[model samples]
Target: MIPDVFAYERPETREGALALLAEHGDEAKVLAGGHSLLPLMKLRLARPSLVVDVARLYELSYVREEDGFVCVGATTRHHDLATSDVARASAPLLAHVAGQVGDPQVRHRGTLGGSLVHGDPASDLPAAVLALGGTLVVEGPSGRRTIDAREFFVSFFEVAIAPDEMLVEIRVPSNPGEQWAFEKLTKRAQDWAIVGAAVTRRASGVGVALINVAPVPLRAAAVEEALAAGAGADEAAQLAAEGTDPSSDFNASPEYRRHLARVLVRRALQKAGF
Candidate 1:
């Protein structure tokens, strides 16, 4: 299928991209890797009048550690994240998850911000970001503001980023001693998870985030609470489906998804050495 007709602009700098976004407003869409957006466009699900390409913005293609956090530029490729020693050292969970996304070709081209902003419930990065308590930095005409991952994703394929805003960076805390695991349930290795779970140990608490169990990726709040209350991994994981309202889809039944969520959460928590 062919995408709807649209004008394209390749911006070489962050400022230029943001300015284009501001100028075109809702009619424009930012393109980083185009892995997600192009498919949606081909299906006519998205038909932006202007496509502001930011793949050429070299400054937004870095993975580095600064201060107490790991700062990843929005345009950094998944393969870069997966292979970067800095990213692996500072955030191995993120690196591991990046390695599992799509195929090697996809990983070589897909951007983290593209995946996060696409807000697909089945995507690995969003759940990992949620578990890592990541923050997104965005730039608009007014300037920049930081949005926590919890607040960044609002609904299915919808994020908190304004039409005039372009995601500029992602910040994740350095949790070197944290135990983490990413369990993806799928029929094939490269397929999206029918259900997935990411578990990590925070300084004073545990973090559990689910993938493909709802309209958007979600945190397992009940499970987290159970863990916080000193429940064993078995007990806490039993509550994984307590608060989620997973829907039945062609790929899975609601009951099956909930069951998978519970099982995957348990396995992930155990694998994380909880």
Candidate 2:
């Protein structure tokens, strides 16, 4: 399939990209790695009149440590995150999840920001970021603002980013040596998870997030509350499905996904040393 005819602009700077987005508004789409947007365009699910390519914006491709966080540039590829020493040292859960995304080719081409902004509930990176309690930074004509990862995903395939805004960076608390684990249930090695769970123990408490168990990637609030109340991992995980609303699909029924959520959350919590 071929995408509809569209004008393409490769911006040399971040500000230039924002300018293009502001001018075109929702008529324009920002292309970072294109893994998420191109397929949708090919299917005619998306037909933006303009594609503002930012894949070469070097200023938006980096991994570094600042203040109390590990900052990752929006355009940084999954492979870069997986292999970044800074990410590995400060945010191992994020690094591990990045390596587990699709296969080598996809990892090499998919940007972290692209995956997050696509807002797929089944995507591994978003759940990882959610569990890590990260924050996203976006820039538009007005200026920059930060959004908590928990509040980023609004609904199925929707995010908080405005049409004229471009996500610039992601920041996760520096958690060197933090205990963490990710569990995914898939029929095939690279297939999307029917259900997945990510757990990480931070100074605040244990963070738990679920994949494909709701309209948006969601935090396991009931499970977290149980843990905070001193429930054992076994008991806390039983509440994994308490607030979820998974849909029945070819992969699995809603009830089945709820069951997997409970099982996997328990595994993840225990594996993370909870």
Candidate 3:
């Protein structure tokens, strides 16, 4: 399972990378940490003509706070997020979830943007970001625009990002000292979740998001709504799988995933002080 031969370019600047994308369009693929894209390429599921590597773009590898949000560069690694004081203070749920991703090697090389853009329903970071109510910033030939995390995942393995656009930053509202928790059922320590739930309680309200319970990383809207209407965690969690369409796989059946969703969501909500 080798990838097809492809031209490679390490862009020195963000603009340089965008220029390459604009030139090659759908035939080009942007490479960040390579944890996500490289696997697809190696499997021959993705056969791009060109790879625009942005791994060396130092400017896009930072975690900082600005205007009441924690802003993370697209190239910021999961290990960085897990260890950053800024991330820990402003977005503890994200920091914790980042630490929970894969093993140490994957955390050190996987970028937050890469994970989010991969749009995997079972990925930990996307569900965490969704629960945190984060936003994604993308830059392309047209310039930069912001997209709500809720609207970013379009479908299974699809995101709102266009071929010519590259995600640049992730913004989550600063929630210093917030109550948050992430719970998941995994077969092994580093295995992907059979079902995962991330919950956060900010001044705004409670946010609940689930992984591997639908075609996309899903916000448990029924659970959130029930909570908003004065329901207890136990009652709200009953609706955790109400709107999901989880698939039956060797790891778990759809019914089993739905049951896990309810149980994990309750655990997360309770831990988050809901």
Would you estimate the TM-scores of all the predictions? 0.98, 0.98, 0.99
Question: Per-candidate RMSD vs. true structure?
Answer: 0.9, 0.8, 0.8
- Across 1-274, the per-residue lDDT of candidate 1 in tens digits comes to 9999999999777888888888889999999999999999999999999999998898888999988899999999999999999889889899999999999999999999899999998899999999998999998899999999999889888999999998889999987777899998888888899999999886867889999988889999999998888888899999999877787878799999999999999999999886
> Candidate 2 — which residues are off by over 4 angstroms?
none
The digit string of per-residue lDDT tens for model 2 on 160-245 reads 99999999999999989789999999999888889999999987788899999999999999999999999999999999999999
Which run of 10 residues does model 1 get worst, by summed lDDT?
242-251
lDDT of each: 0.91, 0.95, 0.94
Clashing pairs in 1: none
Per-residue alpha-carbon lDDT of candidate 3 for residues 1-274, written as tens digits (9 for 90 to 100): 7899999999898999999999999999989889889999999999999999998998999999999999999999999999999999889999999999999999999999999999999999999999989999999898999999999999999999999999999999999988999999999999999999999998899889999999899999999999999999999999999999999999999999999999999998899887
What residue runs in model 3 are displaced by over 4 Å at the alpha carbon?
none
Q: What's the CA error at residue 140 for candidate 3, in Å?
A: 0.9
| Full candidate order by lDDT, most accurate first | 2, 3, 1
lDDT, candidate 3, at 132: 89
